[model samples]
Each structure stands twice: as structure tokens, then as C-alpha cells.
Target: MKIYSSIALSGVAALMATTAFAQGGTITINSFGGAYEEAHRQCVIDPFEAETGATVQIVTAYSADAFAQLRAQAQAPQFDVIHFSGGQEIVGAQEGLLDPIDPASLSNAADLYDFAKSNLEAGEGPAYSIAAIGMIYNTENAPEAPSSWTDILDEAYADHIVLTDISNGYGMLGFLMLNQVQGGSLDDIQPGLDAVSSLLENGAIIVSTSPEIQQEFAQNDAWVAPYASDYAFTLRNAGLPTAFVQGEEGTPASFITANLVAGRDNDELALKFIDMEISPEAQACFADALRYTPTNSKVELSEEVAADVVYGPDAVAGLLRFDPTVIEANRADWVDAWNRTIAQ
Candidate 1:
């Protein structure tokens, strides 16, 4: 069955009444633009609308912009749900912008992998998000896929590599990988920053936007990019000779956190969506279409795809998981250090 069913006329009437009483008429979701957005609509929204009968309106924005908007609306929440990285979710939770989730109602919660559940909880008792991590390289040119971060920095990859912009959360994880390769710890990222600066100096292009990264790699022969495992999978599915790597140091991992807008009008609905998100159907569709590791334990991945996803048993063992708390606290410092040291 498709994930979401269309709302019946009777259900639509009930939703309309509920919305009217709540002072809002629709559920507005803000998400990262491009293919991910499309996948979300297909896998999450369409089904939800069919089943619940409430209108789902998607608002597209860059990750930074989405965060900014969420903060601006904190006093009077506008969006019902916000799809953001775990790091951003940590910040939101700290600022009292997100609501705690109830796992009891989420029937498929048991299906989530242990790591995904633990990462979501972060020891605070509630999960903020679930995510997967991995690397992408073009198979057409690379021929032999790289199995670690060090491979990206090899002189052989010079001038043919593209990396995510360092400002965003995914980019930060990429930076963490470079740090791991350089013998630097996430506790002190200066060494990693230096390594990245060196790579840029040697010809790594800074791809600040996902679309730019996608286009560059898809149209041109930009053979390698350090990206979210899910994104890399999306590229490969599109018939690009792209291959994702499970770094020797293991893969770096992150989550797609759900931010609770402080004054959300549809708190119940928001929670419902979160519950559904972790459902077997939703999680499966998300993993199958977007190449993300399912946080839902019930959702199993194909053996081939599982090998590339960060949370895959073998792959997870090799990953250096980034702590959202640490990232949240030091984001400014990291950014400043990156800007000052990178010279880019």
C-alpha cells in the first residue's frame, strides 16, 4: 500500500472543524528543497493527507533559513513540523522550541534500530531525530570505490572533488571525517579545519548548495563528494555512476530531527506525524526512496543498500558518531575557526 491515503469527505469535514477551532486550517511543513522534499511529499505527505484528510503544505527553504524562520516564529508557531538535522534539533530543544515525543503511540517504534533510537534519545529520554551517514564517489571515473575518508584526500582525487558547504550540519559531519583522517578529535576540530583548508588549497571546490553539488556531479564529471548517505543513494538511483563509501574510521552519522515549535497549534497532529514517521511503512518508503537508514526497527533494508548506509551493522561499527550536544554548543566556534583557518 502507498504510505498515505487520501482523506475521506467525512474525515476532511472533521479536520476542517478541528482546524477552525484551533485557529489554523492546514499543516505546514518546512523542509530542505530539491529531491528530498519531493521524496518527503511522496512518502509522507500524500499518504497522510489521504488518511487524515488534512491539507499538507510544504514550505521549502535552505537548512539555515529554515532554522532562522523557526526561531522567528517561536513566539507564535507557524509550522506544524520542521525537518532539520539533529544538531539543529538539539538547539531547538535547548531553546524550548521543540516538544517531547511519546513513543507509546508510535506502534512502529520498536522497528527502529537501537542506534537510531539511542541517537534520538541522546540520553534525554526522548528522540529528536533519526538519520544515516555515508560517502559518495562517482563509479564511472573512480572505477574502484573508495572505502574511507582518506581516499578523498589522495592526490589522485585532486581537482575532481566536491564537498558540501561547511556551514550546514551535513557539511560539519564531512569536516569531522577530515578531522578523523588527520588524527584530530571532534573535541578539538582545528586539526580537521587545517586538513580541509589544505584540501581546498589543493583544489577541492566548496559546494555550498545541495543542488549545486548534485548538478556538478551529475552533469560534469565531478567524481567524488562527501555527502549524506541518503543523498548519495538518491544520486545512484538516478542512474549516476555514484557509489557511497563506509569509511574505514567508520562513517560519521547524524539524524533528521523533529523540532517542536513552542506554540504549535497542532501539537497532537505534530506528534501523530512523528509517530507515523517512525512507522514501518513510512520508514521503509523513506529508506527505499531516499536511501536513508530507517530508524524504525521494523524496516529492513536490501543487503546491497544496507552495506552503504551508515547505520548498517558493519558500517555503524566503523563510524565516529558526532554528538549533537557537542556540535550544538560549539557551532559558532567551529564556524569561526573554519572561516579564519580555511581562507575560503
Candidate 2:
């Protein structure tokens, strides 16, 4: 059985009731749950429902679990739309699990930045938000903020670091980035393995969930971690004395995209929903709420909010993205290497 969290919005109930007498009652969206899901509800779902008088049901799934569910229900998909972070979108598209999107169908498509509009893999949909991986440290506990990826493994932070397993997206990026920084490529992750193994030997704590990281920080057991910049902001806003910074080398970034599930109902509505996701209003809301960089070129964020996100063309231009195609092809091998050498 697949595990997924579900929520039917309040207004959605009324819409569902009305539609029960008319036609299909809801549109299903699959996404990562918690604060990120809430951000989607506020920025896109609520507004879309208000405008179209449609109810949306949100189902939570991520990474490998998402692909598992799709494969299990290959004949008939449960969700109308799906959201993917990074190269996973390309993976799903290649497997024929996702339907190709028409640029002409998206009203807001022309307004998106080149990166957001990029058809990374054929049939992969439009990108709606940008997130960057970086180091987060407790300003009060750490003697100094970590300025580089290597800092987490430094002797000073040895006992106070929280490391993520390879299964997590942030963990994968962290591992890949460390490998690059230490003169290893995706094809050769031995340097990353050797480095992380050394750190683990020094007492670094390993965790898989975001909440676990938060718990460690709350308990004052961890002083620093490698994670997304938006999550770092979330921790600080939650009253943790936290600061986020990219490594001295550069930052690895990802685009969160929305795709229409293959053979699911409601293509028109799904296209509209995706279009609205990149609209100026929805984009700004996401940016203001979670510091997600808006994909819409027309959306102009204020200085304070933009400061936290990777905003503007120059910043976006400077972002280092692992080729989704390359990452997709070798992720499993990298994970295996991580488990064998580092987890040992």
C-alpha cells in the first residue's frame, strides 16, 4: 500500500457537494506535504478554487514513493496533476507516466523566465518555483556561520552536524556538491564518500526527515546542516537562531515543476491550474510566504523577500544546476555508492 496524506480544502467541500449533482467533483494534486503544501494551498489552490468554483484534493508524495505509486496504478492514475522537484520530472516523463504539455495552452507560459520555460526533458511541464541547496547553521550555537560545504565536516562541527541520507533530495544534492567540491564528479563520488565517512566517524548525526533536523536543532543537539535555503528561512521564522548561506564554491539549485499525469482526467483544468501556478499573483504569494523564487518573469518581489531567494536574471544565471539528464541516469548508482561506503 502507498502512504499519502490527503486534504480537502474547506471551500472545496461545498464545491464537491454541488458538483456531486453535476459532474466530477474534484481535481487531484500530488505534492510534498507540510509547510510546502500549505504554501501551495494559499498561493494557488485557494485562488483557483475561488476563480473557477472547483474543489481540489491534495495528496502528498515525494521522490521514489511518487514513482512507486504511479507504477502501481499504471492503468489508471489517481491524481490529475503531479509535482516534481529537479530531475525526477524528467524521469517520470521518460517513463511515459506524464503527458506532454502544450505551450499554447498555458496563458502564463510566455511570462516565465527561460529556465522556468525550459523543456528540460520532452513532455516535462513548466517550472513554477526555484529552490537552492545551502548550509544552515544556528547563529547562537556555532562559533561562526558555515561558509562552505566542507564546514559541516570540520572538526569544530563534527559532533554538532546533522547529515541527510541519500534518499532525500537535499541529501543527494549535498552529496553531489561535496563530490564536485572535493575533485570528484557524479561518475566518481568516492571523494564525497571518503569525506562523509570521515565526518560520520567524528560523530555527525544522520537523519532522513526535515522534522528530524528540526527536532535535533530544537533539542540543541545539532548546530548545522546542509538543506534548502527556503527551509533555513522556515527554521529562522520558527524562532531558531539560524542563518543560511551558499558554500564558497557555489549553490546547487532546483526547479519545482507541475506535470499532468498520463491518462488522468481533466486535462483542460490541469493546464489551467499549472498556468495559474506561474501567474504573477501565485508566484508572488509563494515568494512572500516561503521565499520560493517565482518563475514568472513578470513577478517583481520586494527587496527584503528577494534578498532571501535567488531572484533576478543575474542570480538565476549564476545558479549551478546538475544536468537533470545526467543526474537521472546515475542517481541510483550514486545512492548505492553512498550506502555502501558511507553508511558502512
Candidate 3:
């Protein structure tokens, strides 16, 4: 809620050993905007700055847009650290755009779950948060709660489904999950495309933004959708008559990660910042505020918050994740295929 324009001089003085005080101990970071940004500001960034005497300037970007900026600034990276949704961090690692986080360097590394630590190769980043792609249905209008991804195609919900754009983080995830559900592999997404085409024919609405989906639900009688758990929480928190459910087949989650920029000058400070992010306090703040599944095994949540997120090792083991390297390489082709086969 509170955005710091500059770090306090005292804080800057404290961090002078590892990072020079420049522009008020400021460092740029890339992440998502809106409600998620607010949560990060309150939960992670604010506390990190308070403790370290640094200022984090958030530059909101996600998925494709985040990658585009990183690619464009390959020679002179603008962000000191970047947070990526899904496995984009893997792509960033492959392209030499990010710095590898040495587990030995982080004191909190031992506290993280095995899956979080094993997110990337030796030099890649680690997972900070987990959010699954699942189904959201308005309880007021839908006859029954959705139990699987296939429920979106049912005639009972005809002309009542709102879908996010495949180019977006969660949308692309939904696309891939549907592909797998219908017996299609990553390379052969035709089955997923065909399923979407059927949904389109049934009068499903393709929405490009979160606000659009909210509007559709408010005005178009859109009662259900396939989306990430975090956004579903956002909707429900805003007083929408909604509930989120992982598909019976399984939930596919995106592991949002923090990567140090390749050429950043403040490597030591950046690593310290990342360490604070995965700390139990920070992780709990996000889970309590936004229902984002924490990667830190030590983070504890209340029964209500725990009920919404994929909590504990057992819940996590049931979720699926795609190969970031594979998805990154074929993303453009898949997006084009989505447009050609369904978006049209």
C-alpha cells in the first residue's frame, strides 16, 4: 500500500558496505502490477527495504512482456532483479539474461521445499511462489461447482464462460493444461485447440484482462472460467460470488521466481533481497493476503488461507509443472496456433 519514492539516508548508510548509495539506495525490480503489486509492496518489498535500508522500484511486467523487455535490454539491463510468472525464469536462464543464485549463499535456502530448490539448473533461479491453473465458478449462477477442466464445455454453461488470452501467463497455462487433458502433448496442441473452438462455438468469451473477466461476470452472465488460483482469490476477495477448484485430473502450477539480472551492479544486495522474499514472514504475508502458495516449507497459514492454496508437500506433489525450456522455445508457435485455430 505504501510505495517508497526513495530509501531513507540512514538505511542507505547501513547498506553502503555491499551496495553504494545511489538515487537513495534504489534498485529496480520487475514484477506484476495491480492487487498483486500491492501485496508485494506490503508483504515483501516494504519489509526488505525497512530492514536493509534500500528502495525497490517496481516495474510491473509479466510473461511475454517481461521477456521482451529483458531481451531488448540484454546489453544494459534496467532491472536489478526480475520476478517471472510461470517458468519464464527458465527461459531467462537459458538466454543468459539472469544470474544464477548459489544456494550456499542464501541462509534461508535450507528452509525451502525440495521442489522450490530444484526449480532450475545449477545456475538458474529458485521458485519463490506457486500458483495453480484451475477452474473458477460463480456460485450464485452455476448449478454445481466445476470439478474438472472439461466442465467448461458443458452446455449448461453455454455463453457463460470467460477465458483469458493465451498470450497472458495464466491463459498460456490453461492452454497447455487443456492440451494435456485432451491427450495432446506440448508439441501437438491440436486437441486443445479443437476443444477451445468448440467452446467458442458455444459462445464463450475470450477476455484479455482481469477487469474484462470481472465485467463479463457482472454483465454477460459469465459463470465459470479456467484461471490461476491467485486471480481467483482476487475475484473472491473483491466480493464476487466465486470459488476456485483444482481440476480432478490435476492442477498445473506456475512457479514464480526471482532472478538477478545478468549485468546488475548490486549482486550482493540483490541476493540478500531475494533471501528476504522467501523467508517465512514474507511468504506468509503473500499467502494470507493473496492466497499465493508459498515455496518456503516453514511458512504456516491459517485454516482459511490454507484451504485456498496448494499447501504442504502432499498438496504440492499432486500438482504438475511443464518444462520452461520447452515452453519458452515453442511459445510463439503455440500462440500463433491458438490464434489460427481458436482466437479467430
Q: Please, what is the whole-model Cα lDDT of each candidate in the order they appear?
A: 0.67, 0.79, 0.80
Q: TM-score for candidate 3, please give it.
A: 0.84
Per-residue C-alpha lDDT of model 1 across residues 1-344, encoded as one tens digit per residue: 33334334434665666643234446778877776778777767766665565577778876567878888987876777777755566677667777665556455556656655553333122232345455678877875677778888887888778877668677888888788778888687877877777788888887787678778887777877888777776677667777677767666777675544557668666666666666666766666667776655456666775655654455455645687778767888888888887665
Question: Which ranges of candidate 2 are over 4 A from the true structure?
Answer: 1-26, 151-158, 201-203, 323-333
lDDT tens digits, residue span 1-344, model 3: 22222333434555675544333577789768877898888777876786576788888897668878988999998988888776667767878898777787787889988878774445467778888788888989998998988888789998988888888878888878888889998778899899889989989889877778777776778789888787777777778887788888778888878778898888887888888787887788888878888889888888888878888887777688877678878888888888887646
- Stretches of candidate 1 exceeding 4 Å from the true structure: 1-26, 61-63, 119-131, 156-159, 197-205, 211-221, 237-239, 260-265, 303-308, 311-314, 317-320, 328-333, 339-344
> Candidate 3, which ten residues in sequence have the lowest lDDT sum?
1-10
lDDT per residue (tens digit) for residues 1-344 in model 2 = 00001122433564556643224447898878987888888788876775557678987887557767877887989878888786667878888988888788899998888777677347788889878888888888898988888777789987898888878878888778988888988678888889888888998887898888888898855898988888877887878877777787878888788888889768888787898898887888888888887778888888878867777776676567787778768878877877887658
Root-mean-square deviation per candidate? 4.6, 6.1, 4.3
- On the 0 to 100 scale, the lDDT of residue 248 in model 3 is 81
Report the lDDT of model 2 for residue 116: 77
